[model samples]
Target: MSRNQRWDFVRNKNLCYCCLEEHTVRSCRSKRDALLHSYQATEEAGNATTGSRRPPAVLFHGGESSKALFRYIKVQLYGRNCYINTFALVDEGAACTLIEKDLADELGLDGPEKELCLRWTGEISQTEPASKLVNLQISAANQGATRYDLKGVRTVAHLDLPIQSLGEKLIKSRSDLKSIPMPTYRNAKARLIIGLDNIKTRENAIVGVPLEGRELEGDDFVAVRCRLGWSAYGRQCSGEASRPRILHVCECNNGDRLHDLDEAMRNHFALESLGVTVANKPLRSKEDERAACIMEAKTTFDPEAKRWQTGLLWRYDKMILPNSYPMALGRLRCLEAKMAKDPALSQFLMESMKSYQEKGYTRQLVREEIVSNSNSWYLPIFTVTNPNKKKTRMVWDAAAEVNGLSLNHALLKGPDILVSLMGVLIRFR
Candidate 1:
C-alpha cells in the first residue's frame, strides 16, 4: 500500500503504526523491544571484541600520502633509577601527558590502576581499565641539566600514533632546516605524548621559525627549534609518502559506571511510599530567622500600585556595599558596542527598557538624585535572546560581583515559600 493509505488505515483502525496492534503508537511495545535488543547486541559485540576489558587500538588512515608534519621531541624519562630515551609527540589538545605502558615498564614505573573513558574521533567513547597514573621525571636528551618532575602521567597500553616517515630530502634541500638536528629515521615511533600538563616540557619542546628568502613563502616544510634540537614539519612533495594523521583522544577519569551502579541500586531499593508523611520539621538557622524577621518588618503593601515593596535582607545591619558603578559602566559600554553592531538587538533592548519604565519597574534617575545617592549600586543589564520564541529579554545581573561580593551576597535569601508538590497532588486527587 502507499504511505498515505497505510497511515490512514492505521489512524482509522486506531492501531499502532509500529506493530499494527490495537493500541496507539505511544503504547507500542515492538519498537521499544527492538531498540532494547539492538542495544544489547551492540554491547555484546563490544564485549566480544574487547576480551581483555581494554579498548582495541584504533588506527585512522589519512589518504595515500601523509604530508602533514607533527611536533616530535626526543626526551629522556627517568623513573625508579632507570632512564629511557624515547621520542614524544607534543599534543596541546590532550589534557594529561600519556606514556606507553612498555616505556613505563622499561623505566620501572608503577602506580595505582585508573579507569579511563577514552573518546576518539566521531564521539566514540569506551571505558578501558588498562591505564594507571605514574610519576616520572623528564629531561631533554640534549639538555639533561634541568630535569622536570612529571606527576600523575597516565600510562596506556598503546598510543595508537600513526607511523610517518619524516621528509629528510626536503630537510636536506634547505640550508637553514639542515643545520638543525632533525629525526632522519625511515619510520619514527612516538611512544609518549607531551600534553599541556607538562608545562616546562611543552615550553621547551617546539618553537617554530620561518625559513629565510624563497624558502619562507613556497616551502612545504617548516623548521622548528626545540630544546633537544631542531625539527621540521610540513607536507612533502612526494606522492608516495604517507599522509600524516592526528590521533584525537580525549581522556575522562570520572567513573561513570560506578555512578550508574550506585544510581541503579538506589532506585532498586527506593521507598515505595508516596505523599506527605509525619516527620520532624527541619530547623532554621539564625540567618534564616533574621531574614524572615527582616522581611516581616520591612514588607509593605501598596493598595494603589497593587504591589508589595520590601527592603533587602542585608547580611549585616551596617554592611557597606562596594563601588560597583565602574564595573557596571564597563559592562554597559560593552553592551553598547554589541548593540551598535546588531541593530535588531539594539531595538529589542531599547523596547524592553522602555517597557520597564512604562510599567514602573524602573525609572530614569535625575542628575541630582544620581549625585546625592553615594551608596547606590548600578545593576548591569544584558539581553538574552530566545530564537524559538522570537523574543529578547533584558536581565539585570544581581550576581555581578565586585570585591568578592555581589547584590546576592549582601542580601539574605528569604524563607522558602514554594508549595510542596506532594501537597498539590494530594489536593488535586
Candidate 2:
C-alpha cells in the first residue's frame, strides 16, 4: 500500500510499515521472531565452530568488585551486543544476588519492569528520594530496550539484549612499543566480533599477589578465568559508540580497569605464568606457582640493549606448577596466515609475548581428560613448561572453576556485583 493508500492514520503497525501484516508476511507470531531468527543465522553462518566456547566465555571470580568491572565493560559495549546473566555466591550477611543494575546500566540493562535489592542496608537519606531515581532510570531503560535497529543478527529476548581508559607513565608510550599484526579480511563481508573473556584469582579479592582486605589464604580456592577476545580487538572496540568491530574483554578479580595498575600487574602475572620472564631468574620473591599453572616462554628486560631478548623456559621441578594464560596469539597467528597488514601491532604484541617468553612462555590450550567414571564432567587442563621454573602441572578444581563462572557471569549482570579490595591494574591503548 502507498503512504497515501493508508486505510488508517496510524498505519497498521500490526500490518508492518510495508503494509504487510504478520499474517501477510508470514504466519509468524511477530517480526521479532523473524529478527531473532535472522540473528541466530547470522551468528551461526559467520562462525564455523561452536564446540569449545568458539568464543570462550571469559569467566571471573570475585564479589561486588566483579560487578564494577562488568559495569565498566558494559557501558563501553552496550547496544549491538548482549551481556549474559550472572549468579552470585552467598557470604557474610548478603544473599549474593547473581544479577545487578550497575552492570545493566553500562548496557542500559534494567532487569524486570520492577525489581528490588536484597534487604541488607537501609534506604539512603537523599533529598530527591530513591523512588524517583528508580522510576526515571526504569523509563530510560525501556526506551533503550527498543532503541537500536539491530540487523545482520538474531531475534529479541523478552528484554533487549544488553551488554575503558588506562594508566599513564611507568608504561611505555605507543611509539615505544612495537605494533601487533592483524589480518585483513578484504573479501570477508559481514561484521565479525573478536572477543576476550577475563577471569581473576579471587572473587571477593584480587587474584595475583595478595593485597589488602582479601579472605583467600592461598590454602583456600584461588581464582582462574578464561577470557576470549582478539588481541587486535583488545586494543580496539570501545563500544558501539565507537565504530569498531573488534570486541575487547579483560576478565579479572576486581573492577574492570581498561587501565588498572593492579589488574595490569596480574595480567602480567598471567603472561609471566605462561613463561614470559621479565627478570633473568625466577620470581622467588613472589608466591609459588599453583599446582595447575602453565608457563609460556621466557624473556627479560634489557633496556641497555634496547631490544627484546627472547628464549624459552620450562619447569624444573615436578612440585612447582607452571603458569599459563591463553592469548589470542593463536588467533592472531591464524589471522597472520592470510594478512599481515598491521605489522606495527603484530610486532608489538609479539614483543610483549617475547618478553613473556623471556621468562619461558608457551601457548595455553585446553586438554580434556576423564577423571571419574560417571562422565559427569571432564577436566579441562592447560599445561606449560618453563626450564627455569619447576615441572609442569595441570590446572583444574571445583572451587576455582565454579567461582570463576559465578564471578565472571556476575560481572555480565551487575554494576558492582561485589565490592573488592584487590589492587587494580590498567591496560594502556
Candidate 3:
C-alpha cells in the first residue's frame, strides 16, 4: 500500500468495520485522537487483530498474482493470522477470486514498507468492477477467440457405478499412474472436493462420527474451522511482522440440506449478480482436489438436489449476508454445532454432546480423482488395496505430526479394507 492510500482510508473514519478500508470512524486521526486524546495511529492499527473467527483456508488458483486481498484483510483484522496459499501465474485472470472473493487480487511489490497503500481496498467481487474484464474474456473463450477466462465454471465428469464396478477399477502405486482409465478436461476451472469421511467438526474441530451404512448416519455434520493460525505465507507483505489471520462469522447446517445451500450460494456468491447453477454428482471431492490443484472443500448434502444442500459448507459463518444482524446470531448457531463435535475431529472431549439435538450423525461417501503428469486416477473413500501394492499415507487429522494408518494392498484387497483401517489408527494430540 502507498502512504497516500493509508491517509485516505484513515481520513474516512465512519465506515463499516468489515470494510477494512482506511475510512473507518476509528481510523480518523482527528477523531481517533479526540476519542482517546492521543496519537498512536500506527501503533493502534498495528495491534489490531481479527476477533475469534476462522476464515476459510484460502488457496489462490489463478493465472496471475494477488496482493489487494491480503492487504485489505490485514487492515480488517487489524493484525491476526489468516492462512493463505498463493499460486503464482504468468497469465493474469481472476479464477481464484471466486473462491477467495473475500480477499484481494493484486500482483506486484508495493515497494518497501508502505502497507498504507490499501487506501480504498474493498472486498472484490467479479460480479462488478473492471466490467467486461472477465466477460469479454469468457465470451472469447466460448467463441474460441481466446484461450481462457474465469467464467463458465469448468465442466466436470461425473460417473456413478455399482459398488462392485468401482471396486474393480482400482489402480495401485505412483508407477501405475498411467494405467488408470480417466476422463479429460478441455481447460482448467473452479473446483472443490466433497468427501464423506466418517468425521465431524464441532466448535471448528474435526472428529470421527461413523455410521453402519447410510448417508450422514444420524446427527453429525461438517463445520468450518473458525480459528486457525497462519502456518506460512505464499508471498510477503511489506513491513510485515507476523503472518495475518482471518475470522469467519457465517452460518451453516446440521446435515445433508443440499437444496438449501444451493439456493443460498446462488445469487449470493456468483458473478454479475447472476444466480449459481447447480451441478450434481460432479465426480468427488478427492478427485477434484487432486485433479484441479485449486481451492477445494468437502461436505455431505442431501442427494435430492432441491431438498437439502448441507454438505461441506455447513456451519460456515454467514456474517456477510445482506442484513446487518449481530455476529452473535451466527455465533450461537455454530455454538450449537460445536457442542456436537465428533471424536475424530475434536481433541476436546465432551461426551454429553454426541448427537446434534438427538438427530444422530450419518457418514457421507466421496470418490477421489488423483492426478500425476497431467492425467487422472480414481480412488474411492473406502479403497481396497492389493496386498502386493505399495503404501499410501492416510491421516485422521490435518496436522502432519499425527501418525495415521497406511494402505497395505494385500489385506485391503483381500478381506475388508475399512475394517482393517480401523485397527491401524494411531492416537495423536
Candidate 4:
C-alpha cells in the first residue's frame, strides 16, 4: 500500500503504525523497546572496551548489610629450618609486619626481644614484654621464584581475620577472577600481616582490580595483583544478623627512655651528697677578657635618659659584617603583604614596635647613617603569638645568618652567670 493509504488505514483502525497496536504511534511500546535495546547495546560496548562491567547493587537481607572486606593472600614464609604456607593479610595502614608467635616458633625463627605497646580497635591496649622480633622471607604460594625479605617482623600471639570464606561458585562464574587461587570450603586463618613497610617498597608493588559484575549471595569483591600473587578482597555476605568485625593493630615502643630516666635519678642523688657546696668561678679565656675590656670602654650611662648604651662585642676587630639590607627588605615586603590581609595583626605589630621605640629599645636610622653603614647587618623582625594567653610578641631575629655568619656568631659568649634554682631556694628558706 502507499504511505497515505497505510496511514489512513492505521488511523481509521485506531492502531499504532510502528507496532500495529491499538494505541497511537506516539505511545507505541515498540518505540520504547527499541530505545531500551539501543541503550543496553551501548552499555555492553563500553563494558567490552574497558574489559570490566559495572558492579551490581548489593542485596540487603533485612534492613542493612554489615559485611566487611579486607585484603588477604596466600603466602609461603621461609624460616631457618623449613618453609610454611599460610594466609596473610596485606594491610598498608599497619606500620610494621607481624607474624604469629606459634608460627614463628614452629619455623625456628629467633631474634632479640623487645617491649612493645600494642593498641587495637575499641581503645584496647596491651603491653607485650620481651616480644621476639625475627626476619623472614616470603613469596607467593603459586609463584616462588621471586622472594621478598621482611626484616624486623614483630611476633604476636595471634592474628585473627574474621571474614567469611569465598565459595568456589563465585570464582567459577567470573572469568577474570577465575585465576585467583583461594581455599575450597573453610576460610583460611590469617597468621601473618604484611604492613606498609613491604607494600610501599618498589620491589613489592601491589595493584587492585575491582571484580565488577561478580556477585554471589549478595557479596562483592576486588582482585589484587601483587608480587605475591592474585588475591580477592571484598564484602562477604553471610546471611546472618551480626556486625562485621575489622582488625586494626598498632604497635609502639614502650618506655624506651628508661635509661635516660635512670641517669637523671643518679645525678639527682649525687647532688644530694654534696650539701651546701659552692660552685667554682669559671675561668675566662683571652677572647673573653678582650671582649670584656672593649665593652667596659665603649659602654656609657646616660644620666638624663636613665639608660645604658654599648657597642657589640666583636669576635675579630677587623672582621666586617656582610650587607643584609636586601634580605631585610624582602622580609619586610613579605610581612607587609601578610599584614595587608590581616588588619588586627598589622595593628598589633605597629603598637608593639611603637612601645619598643618609646622605651629606647630601638631607634630609627637616619639617611646619613644608612648611607655610611654599607656593610652593616640588618636584623629581621617577626611576630610570635601565644595562643593560650592570646598575646602577640615581636621578635628580632639576630640569629639570621648571612654569608656563614650572624650577629650571634660575631659576638662573644660570656661566662655562665645564671644562679642555680636549688641554691636560690635554699638561700630563701
TM-score of each: 0.43, 0.14, 0.12, 0.43
| Model 3 / residue 128 / CA error / Å | 1.7
The CA-based lDDT of model 2 is what? 0.29
- Give, for candidate 4, the lowest lDDT window spanning 10 residues: 206-215
Q: What are the per-residue Cα lDDT tens digits for candidate 4 across 1-429?
A: 655566677678977656777776776656432321345668788888877656577744455564555676777889998999888888766777888899999899999998767777666877667679898888878654577778788988766666455668756766656755654435667888887666644444342122333334434755656667666766644444456455677776435457767888888878876775555855679887888788789999999999889887888887677888888889899999989999998998999889989998888988777762634778898989899998888889989877778889888885445776886887562
Q: Which candidate is the best by lDDT?
A: 1
In candidate 2, position 303 carries an lDDT of 83
Q: Candidate 1: give the clashing pairs.
A: 65-242, 65-243, 66-242, 66-243, 66-244, 67-243
Report the C-alpha lDDT of model 2 over 1-429, residue by residue, as the tens digit. 433445353244455433345445455444443322345667876575664455756744433211111111111123325533221111122211122234334444332342222122332211111111111111011123312211111111111112322222201233222231211111111111111110121233221111322112322212222121111112211222322221121112223333577777888768756953445544332112421132223445678657665432222322222111222234335547533676754565556556765755444444564232311222232334467885444333222233233212221121232424452333222
Candidate 3: minimum summed lDDT over ten consecutive residues — where?
70-79
For model 1, the stretches where C-alpha displacement exceeds 4 angstroms are 1-66, 143-145, 201-215, 241-244, 253-429
In terms of lDDT, model 4 sits at 0.72
What is the Cα-based lDDT of residue 269 in candidate 3? 53
RMSD of each: 29.2, 38.4, 41.4, 27.9
The per-candidate count of clashes, in order, stands at: 6, 96, 69, 0
For 298-359, candidate 1 gives per-residue lDDT tens digits of 99999999999998888888777888889999999999999999999988888888988999
Instruction: Give lDDT tens digits, candidate 3, residues 1-429.
Output: 454555466556544333444465455444223322224664465456544545457864444322212111000111023322222111111221122222222211011111111011133211222211111011111122212222211111211111111112222212222232321222222221111210122232321121121112232211111111111112222222332333121112223357766777675655543664545634445433342332223223665543333222212222122221233345445545654664432323223233422444433334453223211111212112246775322222212111231212111121121434543563111
